[model samples]
Target: VKTTVSVIKADIGSFPGHSRTHPKILEVAARRLKEVEGSILIDSYVTHCGDDLELIMTHTKGEDNEEIHKLAWDIFMECAGLAKEMKLYGAGQDLLGDAFSGNVKGMGPGVAEMEFEERGSDPILIFMADKTEPGAWNYFLYKIFADPFSTSGLVIDPSLHDGFTFEVHDVIEKRKILFNTPEESYSLLAYIGAPSRYVIKYVWKRDGTIGASTSTQRLNLMAGRYVGKDDPVMVIRAQSGFPAVGEVIDPFRTPILVAGWMRGSHHGPFMPVGVADANCTAFDGPPRVICLGFQVCNGKLIGPADMFDDPAFNRVRDQCCDLSSVLRAHGPFEPHRLSLEEMEYTTLPGVEKQFKDRWEDLPE
Candidate 1:
């Protein structure tokens, strides 16, 4: 069976400010999404990470299907109206456009879609992040697809030994390039290492089978200003020819630092949290990531086994909290706060202009 999985997410609004989505608004989104099921989707799940609501659906419509995209767009708009009436925080905040332009790509929401022939037991995983940019997934993608330390399969499994290919996007330039791994892994890193500018858009197995994908929309670029952080969603297919489920989730156990915290302006550990615990608080984050694992049979979505809802991840979350305090102590310093260039949504540019004349000329 050919299955197309589309995950679209946006910060329609949050209850009491960037913390969580209200139950009422989720009801609005859930109800609308349910309406399109028999006609537009095979199976659908509505969930959220931090303030962004996610519509995860399985369909045969393929990637970038206008009807599917429009369904997501319509759901968000209706939810936004409910949010507005409820006086929710940042209501309709991520809907940057006055109207949907036949698709939601530039309109505001972050989307990641993939279509593939389902294996006998198609186990898929989604990593949804809150309070971070899309580039935040770069490191995780690299570790799972390229690094032998995290992905033991890379060294042991013959299928993975040939290595995978990376599709990277320069979010600022809105351009992309592909690099085959095992040979070009380091070359791939030289760019994604920055994370803020370059992002891994997709990954493919040696046989050209798609392995993973991340939403590449930099909301700042589309909105021409900072509206909300490009809190991203990612899809990864596991087992068989690809990395095992363990290899994919191993990288997050270390709690790597990523750009996105309070106001999308700081660096913080991307904490792996259970879906129920995914809300932006703490200094507006220690950015949270929730992984939902599913087994697809025919066209049905069988499980969203909250991947991090295990005791195994408790230490990771605790370590992330400890690290967040250390970074937060820096309080506006580099390596903690994002650099000027990375602060694409910040007021730093105008602040730079205001302070420009006060500086004395430096020695040549």
Candidate 2:
């Protein structure tokens, strides 16, 4: 059976500040999805990463299906309503539009979806992040799909020997390009290295089978303001022709620095954490990402194994803490804070305007 895995997420509200989602909001989302489980959805899982509420669903309906999108939008709307009642912070903040159109892509919420034939034991990983943009996934995607050092299967396993293709998106230009790996890896790196502009949107196997998909929506761009981080979500298939679950997740062991921390303007280490510990705290982030493993059988989702709940990842968590301290020490300096181009959506413009009249020309 061809099954579509859709992972949609939005920050409708959070308790106290932008640290975490309210339990009531999650409860409402669960209840609403449960209502349409057997009819509209084959299986559904509701989760949260920091303040972003994530809805993962398996269905026969293909990607970007209007019905599926509408169901998710309604659930978010209902949860946002309950959040407002509880007086939570930034209630309905991600619902950029007054009404849901045919789709939710441009409306606000981030979506990453892919449809494929279910293998004998279809294992998949859903990664949801908070306080970061879509570009945050670029580093790991390269390691997982292109670098043989990171994924030994690329060199050892015959099935993966042929390599994969990366679908990159220039979010600013609203264009996409495909590059086959091991052949154009250098060209690919030249673009993805500057992730704030070019983002890896999808990865496909040599046989044309889907390997991974990421939500590339830029929330700040869509809203034309500093509403918040994009808080992207991603889905990656594991085992068989694809990389093993271990290879897919091994890259995150090194906490790479990504943009999006406090006020969606600073750079911080991308820390991997379990769902229980996915809330933002220090510096309003350090930017947390949670991985949930699942098995799809006959269009149903089974076993959402929390991939980061192991003691093996404890060292990395400590490293992230150490890195966080170093970055925080920079305090408003470059490398810790984003560059001027990236600060376009933030309050930098207003601050620059305030001092515009006092500036004088420099000596020739």
Candidate 3:
């Protein structure tokens, strides 16, 4: 029997502000899953990314199972109804499509799951981020996948010697192009360095061993409007073949900044936070990411280690605190404001709205 773990996420609702999910909405989702658990799933866990709610399930159904996908879809719909009832901010925000058309891939919501011949004591990381888009993972992925500074395994581990291949997507074009790393790596970095656009959807070892994967399809790109920011989710198989858990987490400690805070617009340091920690102080964030380590065998989840809960990492959190205050103090200055390209979805919309009549041709 082959084991598989699926990490599916979608924004159900938020409290008045886009702070966190309403508890009752999560309860509805959990109850809906519980009713069908013994019949459709082996075991499961439910969590959130700021306003988005995620359902991580273990099953034999493999990727995009209709029953499994529908189970998640229905739960989100129920939760969306609760959001509407409560008149929460960004209610039913991630449920973009008119209906769940087979899979949730382009419909709305972010989904990343992989089925593998289970490795004994298989440890994996489940990462969920909010108040930002999928492009936010670009820097973290580059460090873990390509850079020697972050992943020493590129030299230490023979299996990693061949390096990894990257499939960079022109998310706007809905087109994908491939490049092999340690070779064409500089070219890959030139594009992916801009986190608001390109994102790493999946990564594999030189020998075809799965290394990392994330849902790449951004709903805003597909929806053609500010439907909501892409609250992304990722699942990584760690240790041994891939980078160790530290390599996977070290990049976050730098508090590397990205675009997104209030209205999914603004810049702030990326904070390495723990489970159930989703509150933006004043500027809307310190955009946050959480790691929940898990073990699976024969399609069942056995262990989940909260990766950020360590005394050694406390200083890094403090550093992020300082960076957040520094950036917040700037209060919408150049660089502190998002890059021009990213601004297209934010303030530019209002700026463009003002110029709508100016473009009217008189004598061209």
Q: Pick the candidate with the highest lDDT.
A: 2
Model 3: per-residue Cα lDDT over 150-193, one tens digit each: 88988898877788877777787677887788998989998998
Candidate 3 regions exceeding 4 Å error are 355-364
* Rank by lDDT (best first): 2, 1, 3
Residue-level lDDT of model 2, residues 72-97, one tens digit each, is: 99988888888899899999999999
The deviation in Å at residue 147 for candidate 1 is 1.2
TM-score of 1: 0.96
Which regions of candidate 1 are displaced past 4 Å?
A: 353-364
Clashing pairs in 1: none
Candidate with top TM-score is 2
Deviation from native of the Cα of residue 1 in model 1, angstroms: 4.9
> Candidate 2 lDDT (Cα, whole model)?
0.93
> Over all chains combined, what TM-score does candidate 2 have?
0.99
lDDT (CA) per prediction: 0.88, 0.93, 0.77
Number of clashes in model 3? 1
lDDT of 2 at 98: 75
| CA error at residue 321 for candidate 2, angstroms | 0.5
